[model samples]
Target: METSKVIVEHIFLLVIVTLFSVLQNAFFAVKLEREGKGGNATAFERVSCAVRNCMDAYPTFLAVMWCAGLCVSQGPAAFAGILYLVVRQKYFVGYMGQTSQSTPGFMFGKRPIFFLILMCMVGILNYLLGHFYGRCYKAQLETLTSVVAALLLIP
Candidate 1:
């Protein structure tokens, strides 16, 4: 598939995921209110914080996803985006339950973002190297770059 098509599909998926997160947060708030826990300001605070965290990270995530999609590979970029959605969902559920339970999901959610950032850095490096050293090194650098990107997924 063409890169633009792939990127658009990824963006669509991101939008759906974002909506789900928002809905999930709203569900928590409604449930808390029904249970009469809403009177406890901390309960509302926790839910709002969770939702706010997602909102805070979203723009940066979108930017990084776009950079990876344009500069690296669409498949990997989309994979990272989907992974973000999954981990963020996990995080929301856990945070709603207990703060301690949220750590694992929060930590895992960061991995894909870090990988995306690394991919962007590598892409810039590759471009610069290709330009300065000529085409002779471009193929080798591309291979090396892919290897490094793949290694980021390892435990």
Candidate 2:
């Protein structure tokens, strides 16, 4: 199992993906901040909405997916689901934190980068653990995830 790239990738997502999403999600909380003179909600309300819209991930889905992948076989799909979610969280955080000039650079650059990395990680990992076993499938996603992850960790 130590040599399983699938395991390694899953662990990476479990730690970095989840941590980044939660922190970014917390930082990402949206708020209206305007009192209801007629039609307005507070920041708390917006945040609560976002929280509700979240992909319902937690100890169960994520853990179960990984467990199923290893223990049963249908786990990778769960893991993929979780991966998609965490990636979405990152997108939400980035979207809510962008500026003007940084729009293209943000959208064309960071957004794509984030999408590619997280997406590839989820896809490749799922494929590996699910069917391929180790046939090698371009691995661009792994490269992106690892590189971006390293960059994010940098000061």
Candidate 3:
């Protein structure tokens, strides 16, 4: 497949993941109101924490997703992205039930993200080594960097 096609496919997957994240937040908000907890700041605290955690992780997730898709392996990258969405959903739901029950979900979500980060770091190091070894890594690195920048710039 062409590089652009691959990138587009990965972007679509990322969008789906993003939509799921939004849905999770919406679910929590509805739950809060339905349970008469909307007025309870403490009741909203867990949901808020979950939403904030997602927000904090999102940018890194995008960067790693793109880097892995372009430089590492698109299939694995996409799988990891989907896995993140699944585990994150699990985390959100588990946290809604009980804070203690969220630990497994948190670990599941975190491990895939950690792996993706490792993949991104390895991909970058490989590109750097190729550059040092006189290969044409600069163009690829620039392309990846540009894509990441564009993604980050998106609201």
Candidate 4:
């Protein structure tokens, strides 16, 4: 439940996601070679595109996740990060199968990103109110975050 532990989990998740992307690319490359499809575009284009899309969104996901983790709360941030990673993988796999199938994964995965961004906004608001007017909402926000996290089974 400690912040450090949550952050470590986030770091681990980041490593796993990165590794998945890299390994996926390598696998696709090998598959292409084995199929005698060197150079020019091939069926592997779908797989490559899936991987590229996932990597492209990685930076935004990382930023919002860490901002929420450090500024708002770690538990919820960790939960969101895990959800995002899982959905991202789902998106990749689904896309490789069929582009339209990826839509569900994309829709589900964005919730976590949005949640983190909202948390960041709340965190900033909390800080601003407390710093500028001695009306700190830390306790209130923590209670609310915990309640929401509990409802979502965040742990």
All models: lDDT? 0.69, 0.44, 0.67, 0.72
Better of 1 and 4 by lDDT: 4
| Clash pairs, model 2 backbone | 31-43, 32-43, 69-75
Ranking by lDDT: 4, 1, 3, 2
Cα lDDT tens digits, model 2, 1-155, are 66797767655544554465466545544332222233534434544444444434344444543443333233233344444554555444443344233233223333333433344456656667657565444355445444544443232
lDDT of 3: 0.67
Candidate 4 residue-wise lDDT, 62-140, digit = tens:
7787677666677677677777777877887788778999998898887888888888899999889889999888767
TM-score of 2: 0.32
| Candidate 3 lDDT over residue span 1-155, tens digit each | 69988668756655665566567667766765654555766657776776667668877877787676667656566667777777777777787777888887787777667767766886778778877885645456545544543342122
Work out the TM-score per prediction: 0.68, 0.32, 0.66, 0.72
Who wins the lDDT comparison? 4
**Higher-lDDT candidate among 1 and 2?**
1
Candidate 1 wrong stretches, greater than 4 Å: 1-40, 136-155
What is the lDDT, from 0 to 100, of the residue 111 in candidate 3? 65
Instruction: Please report the TM-score between candidate 3 and the true structure.
Output: 0.66
Q: Is candidate 2 or 4 superior in lDDT?
A: 4
Clash count per candidate:
0, 3, 0, 0
State the weakest 10-residue window (summed lDDT) of model 4. Answer: 146-155
The most accurate candidate by TM-score is 4
Question: Which candidate order results from sorting by TM-score in descending order?
Answer: 4, 1, 3, 2
